[model samples]
Target: MNNRTGAIESVAGNSNFAVNSALSFGYRWFDPERWGHWSFDLDFFGSYMGVGVSGFGMSDHENLGFLGMRGRVGYRVWHDRLEPFIGMIGGSVLANTASGGVDHGAVWGYWFSPTGGVRYYIPNTRWSISLDGFFRFIGGVNGLSGPGVTINEAPHAGLGGRWLYEPVGIVALGYRF
Candidate 1:
């Protein structure tokens, strides 16, 4: 499950929240006898970020969607039932702005996140639960311009040209095989 939620505070001093859901699949490999409690994982995910409502007080116009993959390294502790992990994610996104139900042109961009999480495995079952958090960085590279908002009457965007930062939290249920 890729359902996530988070808060956004804009330069205009407006704070709002966003929600997104996705489907994901992953593979984990661990060899406790040889590698202690270390593990490696790779996951692929796709999600729809929903309509863009500018936290900066601008009118909502864009619908954003993304598809991404993550790679993680983890260390297990406490009878091998608890694991803490760190990972990185990279993906492509599509943003489209519309007015009056008329479709506008779509712009493509790239996004990345530096993520970490903890997972707890059930004592007697191949099941687990996790809580993950990350800060996502987004930027438009093609045909999408203009600052998202302004602060002190000055334009404020992300790093490296035009960028946006979003913080997210996720709670997930999992199965291990």
Candidate 2:
């Protein structure tokens, strides 16, 4: 979430967190045992962003959805039960609405995040869990324009700032075949 509001009227202070839900499908290329304890994966995912979760103190409960893809490389350690990885994800916003603060326009843009994490595979099973952290960069196409609106007079560039930054956390459950 970009902290610098560009022109949107409704003001919501900048916070360090965002709420979202996502699911990912991926394929691993090789067995670590045969590849010197290193593995690589490519994944495609979709997520729904839940802004203003409770709207407890805000005026609007806004939200959106997006799809993205990422690639990760991990190195196994501790008997191959734990692996650490680094990756990058990029995507575009696919949907939005015309209600509530700052983003009450047809918002579309691109975003990317650089991430790092660790995965723990359960013994004797293909199940695994991961925890990751990332910082995302989001930018709009010509600063939030919609029908009957011009970039110069668009109702406050959605989300204000031409670009925004968000620090995000992710937890994922995985299954390998």
Candidate 3:
């Protein structure tokens, strides 16, 4: 009976994890301006994540998902064709979970994340794209779960990193206000 239960649990968990992974994506907008020949940017983005747990005797462990929103303000150190910029980011993650036999289950919680990253912009065009990376510190109450409940687990508070893909790397495309 125990073996059968474990097998059922394993199959259920994998299925949930797959669903979560398929739904992950991030979207953002930004606005940059030049002052004293230095460019400043304000940007915002939303992210969705799904994580699975595997590594213990526990087959009934839960799967996690998060909906996150972030805002950043940055300065361009170099303003040439390949512009390099430094910036600070602040955001919150709305964590949730999916568990318990094909049912979409969730618990609510919030975490604050701070991050920094560099962006490289392609030169000369109101339509340019950039790649940015950042880290976040997560915290809050949405990490715990009860029986038949799915909760989004926060990553250990501290440093984290992400890759940001800007469709139009141009400053005009990402307007702050």
Q: Best by TM-score, which number?
A: 1
lDDT of each prediction vs. the true structure?
Answer: 0.72, 0.70, 0.40
List runs of model 2 lying over 4 Å from the truth: 1-16, 53-58, 95-103, 141-161
Cα lDDT tens digits for candidate 1, 28-133? 9899888889999999977766654444344456567878998999999999999999999879887766432334567677788999999999999999999988
Q: 23-134 in candidate 2: lDDT tens per residue?
A: 8898987574578989999999778776553242444344557678988999989988999999899898643533233354556777788989999999999999999888
Cα RMSD to the true fold for all candidates: 8.8, 6.2, 8.7
lDDT ranking, high to low: 1, 2, 3
In each prediction, how many residue pairs overlap at the backbone (N, C-alpha, C within less than 3 A)?
0, 3, 7
Indicate the worst ten consecutive residues by lDDT in candidate 3.
Answer: 162-171
Candidate 2, residue 132: Cα displacement in angstroms equals 1.3
Error of 1 at 58 (Å): 11
Ranking of candidates on TM-score, top first? 1, 2, 3
Error of 2 at 51 (Å): 1.5
* Best model number under lDDT: 1
lDDT value for candidate 2? Answer: 0.70
Which lDDT tens digits does candidate 3 get at residues 84-165? 4555544444544433423344444444444444455545544444555444444554435655443334434333532211
